[model samples]
Target chain A: MKYSPALQGLIEALRCLPGVGPKSAQRMALHLLERDREGAVELSQRLQVAVDRIGHCVQCRNLTELEVCEICADTRRDAATICVVETPADVLAVEQSGSYRGRYFVLMGHLSPIDGIGPEDLGLDRFERRVAEEGVAEVILATNPTVEGEATAYYLSDALRSRGVKVSRIAHGVPLGGELEYVDGSTLAHAFSGRRPLE
Target chain B: MKYSPALQGLIEALRCLPGVGPKSAQRMALHLLERDREGAVELSQRLQVAVDRIGHCVQCRNLTELEVCEICADTRRDAATICVVETPADVLAVEQSGSYRGRYFVLMGHLSPIDGIGPEDLGLDRFERRVAEEGVAEVILATNPTVEGEATAYYLSDALRSRGVKVSRIAHGVPLGGELEYVDGSTLAHAFSGRRPLE
Candidate 1:
């Protein structure tokens, strides 16, 4: 059941992707070799270029080719308001919503004390300096509603409040399309507690 | 919502894989860029190597770095008995079973007149020549049990019978580990008609 060396190598390499297992890796390798040679070559070249060129944005810690990310560089975006997220993917998600015109800060990961990740690991000190020096008036925490995300938001709120920046967390509640019956207890509780009066 | 040029290219290229849509492609691109840079670089290099080197086997149309595939090159297999399959993936599946010790001929696809695919497209002429010149005794039609596959099998049987070679189609029946009640009606009928008495 062993494939040729080149094919074996390709299959093994493809397994590095998240959720791709041995069977899926083999299928992908065969598919690329059999049907999409040109696309495969293009993918290879692009992968190399991305790996070599893409780096963390200096200002926001999001992935970028330049020193600062596009969001951080755009003068039209509200530099006075910074929305913080756990990963670059989250930055993309928020951008896709198109409701926010502010800049972003990617923590790359949430703090996990058991894993030895702390405020320094998430570049909170640098973020603090950016808030003060760049005259950021508001800091919005948009991290996920998990335990670590909540803990990170709490820590960042405490750390930034002394610097005179208004701190706020994104609302936690039932998702827009989610049925109330299907919504979990904690989320329902949060939604009820955070209810606002109609204007 | 636009990614950098290199990142965008990588994501688009990744979409060429089967079952990978835009969201999965984006997730894969970000995962490779953010978490597994070294693995990403290796995958890129391996993809290039595989694409540059792997080609169809001259004898069986299976993938190989050599002119002939490993199975075709092997001296221990029964060259006189050739198992014909619709795709190279089927060749791997049959090989994994370890029940057949014969050589293989990959048709690459089934006969579909509406799609303009014919016996010539499946390289049946070359296969006929191989059967006559190489002294092949048996030709096993292991194509899938689909409409096009059944038509192809019938065509091959008629064509090869005139050449005095034994042409046999693989049995169509209930699959192993399948329950009788759960099996489809056509497959159950096939199993009933093709049944043999226990020895």
Candidate 2:
């Protein structure tokens, strides 16, 4: 159907979002125009503000308005330990868990050779320099358990080990509250192989 | 977690979209910041442009950059037959069906006394005037099947009938390609009651 030029432009722009199709784009456009004009204006202004101000933390590559992220700037966090993660979302997940008190090193993405993403692309050189210069004692590998994550973890382990830092991978086990029967075979195998003796 | 001010604002703004919660808003914000910066800029620009340029069509209340919507301004459509719908989205749906060559009258919303939406709120007075002035022969009620939709349809039917105009409600029956067994009881009942005789 032929929508007005402005409405059509709005719909096309909305389609850029993840999982949003043409129908959803149309619905969103109409809803914004009809009922939530103020909210749409706020969203547009915020989008511009976020794009202009939010940038990667110089210290850990996490999102921040300043030079370094809050976590990296805080003196309370364990400066000697760094958790390596794939994305800023992963940092949020680990923070929500409230179990990890160390700083994070966000890779932004894992090593994807097919996508031409290598160690240089992930700022691994900067990470290595920080580990050595900051006297980090331990490096935690918290990348996803996928093939790419595993490869990146291995590479980071080797790179950090040369700097005299201990490297550890987060345990691969059935998630807390998850039944053993529902756990996939590969995860169960990893859990079994990495089993610790009952204290 | 404590996000940067701009990032937090962006996430909050994203939550204004229908069905988008905090988690999805966060994901969208990060995705736009990390992967699709250009698309985010485009979306923001288009949103501003749409809000600035688009307005309700003077005649049909559908979205338009001009004074009247394209469908309403088209000369080929049957101006005597007006399809009354609850929203601009509904107008698009009818247009896409390709069967209806009639012009549309968008109500923007249905009547709901609880929400303080009365006849005047939906521009019913304007609709009445248009029917008489334009020499409208038929008014097709294409409102949704919800209770409010039914009430609005009934209200319009009565209002138009007093002005000596023919009013017809869109049929409520089993949808095309729907199997009788899988159809809901209410829909099956509607189909049974509205069944047509074989020629």
Candidate 3:
């Protein structure tokens, strides 16, 4: 016989998570029911609360419960330079690096004409308004290095240049700890093309 | 900046699931928020419902929302033979194989004295009561091949022999699809010792 209705429902519902499959879902459901009911309850409560409370920041379009996200609300951060990224996770990635001191603008997704996504869908109008009205000096394009991400960065650079703001894309190259032999061809090409002369 | 409070809480809670780490938790939480809010809501509702409703079946100690599980309630299944397994998942595994026509008794866990889990914790006394009252003729031990599982099986076999019930353990061998050359020494040894002559 199959699992009881509630157990079956939990397993099926858990499949919505990225990378989770039938076996993993079953394991997770059983693990929770058999050993960690408290954790399951906490997870359920937290998921519900997060879904109910979380929303996009009004100014930067990053995820937040407040109208403005923490980085966007901070006065100590440099407001003149904005780092544009494709998702909220990228904001966290940059923040964890502890190098960027500027605020951020989340595009939410890259331009994909095949998928019907465009500038308006990415809130570029709002971003441009912020740029023109706030006297922003530079915008860094930190979208992924995929084809769609490159196309998005190119489009943004064209748009921002005409608006009189300096636009720069994050560098692509071999990673710091990676060996040359294992570096992908496209990245090696990017490293060669964007090479700098050491003083 | 760190993830917003609600998002952070959701991510942290998601980590309660097995095989999910910080990165996977963030991805799952953000994925649910961005792409599958409906799924997230369903998951939350189902998890809450499952935890609140699901409990061990009174007769078999298997997980179910009712006093007796569907397998136990079904009259067509053989009541004279019982397949004793370690968990509800094992019950499903046996059912899916379409081989066993008998009812099941779930141990919930194996005997591990170091963890202070005893026969009472495994509901062995309840199992014994069923064997005595229900006229059960045979019991199949389908516990895992681990040391604890073997110990549990041996303990159950010894206890069941005195109750006028035929006790048997499922075979330990190289799996149907596995190559014998690559099989572990213990499994190979068990396979050799348990070999039966062709009729």
Candidate 4:
């Protein structure tokens, strides 16, 4: 079917979202096409504004509007501690739980040699430099529990270890309130190996 | 937690999409915040462009830039045969099957008395006048099989029958290749009641 150039263009742009396949993209496009033209236009406008105005904080690579993100600039947060994560989404997840009060260092992505993404790709060099220059006492690896995430954690850990920064990897395997019978074998094994002494 | 005005403005706008709850909206907002400025600005530009450029076709209510939709203007299509539908998405479903050569009349929505959306609200007035004047030979009721959809079809049928125009509803019950055991009881009942004479 011959769709208007504007509709086609809009759908193509919307396809960038995660899990929005062609059919869903088309539906969204048509929905936008139908009711709320003004709202749709506003949404499209905001997409550009957001992508333009938002940038990585120079200190931690977290999303920010200024030279330093709020977390890095805030005096209430512990400047000596840094929770390193793989993406901005992870930062939100951590923030949602409201447990941590320290600053963060976003890796942007994890190491995957097959995809040609390695240590250098994730701003580890900058992190190492930060550790050397800043009086950072501890670095927490909050990367995902996936294999690639674990691998990236180890790489960062070893790199920061020589610089005299205390490094710790976040625990993996077995979620809270999960049934023992439903737990996978691989996760069970990892939990056994990573067991820590209850102080 | 407090957020920058620019960041929050963009995020607030993005929360309008379907299924995008507050937390997901935050992540999306933060994601866009961190990306290059060029993308967000470009998205804003596109939004206005799309809204201004796309409007409803006069004939079918489908999204279009021109006075009449492409489907309405197609010479090969049976203009005398009209397929009545509820929404733009439903129009696409019929189009994808590629079986019908008839043009369409999109109601934009179905008649729902409980929601205060009546015949006039669904553009049935325009449909009635168009069928009468357009030399329309047949009106195919291709609306969904839901209660509202059925009510809409019956309403349109009764309203148009007095004009002596041939109005037929699409067959209900039993999808092609659907297993009998898995079919719902209501659908099976519909199939049995509406069973045609076996050749």
Candidate 5:
């Protein structure tokens, strides 16, 4: 069916979002036009504002409207300890865990040579400069457990250790509530190999 | 983690889309900001333009930028045989099937008294007026196969029949290429009860 030009445009544009396909885009467009015109307007305005204003924090490379993010600006947080993560979402996950009291450095993405991503693309030079300037004592490598994440963590640790900075990787094993039988083989193996003796 | 004001606003606004929750909204917001700013801007512009320009077609209440939709304006299509559907998406589905040569009447939604929607909301009076004015020969009920949709179909048929207009319902049975063994009990029962004699 030939939708009116504007309607068709909206449907096609909605497809740009992750996971939204043709059918979903159609449904969303119709829903916004029919049931929630006000919501659509709000969304449009917000998208415009966000796209125009939001930029990476200079200190942590996390998304922010300001030069520095809230976490980076907060003086009470530990300046000597930095938790490195791949994306802003990872920062949220670590914050939600509520155990960490350190600052964060968001890489935005991991090392991906095939995709042409490198340390420079991830702002490793900026990170190294920050570490030196801040007199950071320890760095926590909390990049994901994926191969790319591990590679990035290893590179970061190698670079930082050469400059006399202590580095630690987050544990990779079965989740706290996960059953052993359901745990993947590699993770189970990691758990067994990394097990610590009782004091 | 506390996202910047603009980023937070975008994430919240993204949740207005159907089926998008907090996590999905966050993901979409970050993705658009990080990887697809141009797409986000295009989506925003399209959304604004659609909301500003698109309105229901006066003839059939289908969404369109013009007073009459393309299907309604076409002279070759059978205006005397109006295929009624629950939404514009259903119109697309029927159009894609390539069997129906008739124009469409989009009800936009089914009659649901609980949701405060009635014949007036479905524009049944407008449909009736159109049928009378155009000398419509047949009205095909192609609403969804749900409770509200069935109730709506029955109501439309009854209303149109009283006015001496022919009305027919699309078949409800085992779908083509679907196995009988895997078919649900209710559908199988519908197939049995709706059985037609072979020529």
Candidate 6:
């Protein structure tokens, strides 16, 4: 079927996101055109505003409208402790928990050898330099529990260990009330290896 | 979770659209900040452009950036015949088939009662006027096969029958080679009843 090129273009553009597919894209495009004109416009405007105004924080590479991110700029945040995460999304997740009082360093991506993504690709040179110079007492590796996440955690550990920074990965295990059988193989294995003493 | 008010505001605004729930909106908000800044800006610009510029064509009530829609503006399309549809997206569907040579009359909605959407809400008066004045030979009611769609079609048929225009409803049946075993009751019954002479 020969759809209008304009309509097709909109759908294709929407499909660029991580999980959205052609059908979902079509629905989104139509919804934007029909109902949420303002919302769609806001989304588009916010995107451009963010793109033009926002960039990686000079300290942590987190998405920020300023040179230094909100976390880095906050006077109350512990400058001595830095939580290292793979993406800005992870930083958001940590922030949502509202428990961590430390600053953050967003790697912006994980180390995926199969995908040709490595330390250099993530600008780890800058990160290592920051870890050494910034007087950060401890670095918590909060990259996801995927293979790439683990690899990134290890890579960061090796790079920053020489600078005497205490590096640790985020704990991975069965979710609250999750059955052992229901847990994925990788997560289950990580849980077994990283087992802590039960109080 | 203590997200910034501005961030929370943006996410809530995003969830107003159909299919966009809280989680999806949150993900979209993060993606906008992190990866797809330019794309988001473009989308925002397009949304505004579409909302501000595109409106109903004075002649056919189809969506248009100008007073007359692209289909109505095209000299090659048959103005004498008009295909009536419920929404602008429905216009796209018909256009995608590449079969119809006529222009379109977009209702923008249907005769939804529980939702307080009536004939006036769908701009049916404009349709009646267009049919009355314009030399429209035939009106193909291509609304979706739903209750509101059926009622809208019936309403239009009764109104147009007195106005000396050929009014016809689009065919309802199973797709070609669609097995009866897989087909639903209503569709199967419709297929059996509307079955044509075997040549």
What TM-score fits each model? 0.96, 0.97, 0.97, 0.90, 0.97, 0.87
In model 2, residue pairs whose N, Cα or C atoms come closer than 3 Å (at least 3 residues apart or on different chains), thus clashing, are: none
Q: Model 2, A64-163: lDDT tens per residue?
A: 8999789988999899899999998899889989999989999999999999999999999988998999899999999999999999999999998988
- Candidate 1 yields a Cα-based lDDT of 0.92
What's the residue-level lDDT of B36 in candidate 1? 98
Q: Residues B105-141, candidate 4: write the lDDT tens digits.
A: 8888889999999998878888899899988999999
Give the CA lDDT, 0 to 100, for residue A192 in model 2. 94
* lDDT tens digits by residue: candidate 5, B70-162: 898999999889999999989988998999999889999999999999999889998887897789999999999999999999999989998
Per-residue lDDT, model 5, residue B6, is 95
lDDT of each candidate versus the true structure: 0.92, 0.92, 0.94, 0.81, 0.93, 0.77
List the candidate 1 regions with Cα displacement exceeding 4 Å: none
lDDT by residue for model 6 (B1-199), tens:
3344445565676675567788888788777766676666666565555556666678777655567767888999888888889877787778878889998888878898999988888878877888779878999999888888989999999999899999998888987788878989998888788889989
DockQ of each: 0.77, 0.81, 0.89, 0.51, 0.85, 0.40
Cα lDDT for residue A64, model 2?
89
Query: For residues A146-186, what per-residue lDDT tens digits would candidate 3 score against the true structure?
Result: 99999999999988999999999999999999999999999
> Residue A20: error of model 4 in Å?
0.3
Model 4 segments more than 4 A misplaced? A196-199, B2-8, B23-46
TM-score of chain B of each: 0.95, 0.98, 0.97, 0.91, 0.98, 0.92
Q: After superposition, how far is residue B102 of candidate 1 from its true place, in Å?
A: 1.1
Instruction: For residue B42, give model 1's deviation from the true position in Å.
Output: 1.0
lDDT of 1 by residue, B1-199 (tens): 8887788888998998888999999999999987899999999999999999988899998888999888999999999999999887799899999999999999888999999998998999988988988999999999899999899999999889999999998998999999998999999999999999999
Lowest lDDT 10-residue stretch of candidate 1 chain B: B1-10
TM-score of chain A for the candidates in order shown: 0.96, 0.98, 0.98, 0.92, 0.98, 0.87
lDDT of 2 by residue, B48-163 (tens): 99999999889988889999888888898899999999988788788889889999999999999999999999999998999999899999999999999999999999989999
Q: Write candidate 4's Cα lDDT for A1-199 as tens digits.
A: 6467777777777655544577777777776666567668678766765565667788888766788987788899988999999877787778878999999999888899999987777888878998889889999999888889989988989999999999998877789998879999998998899888999
- Chain B TM-score of candidate 3 stands at 0.97
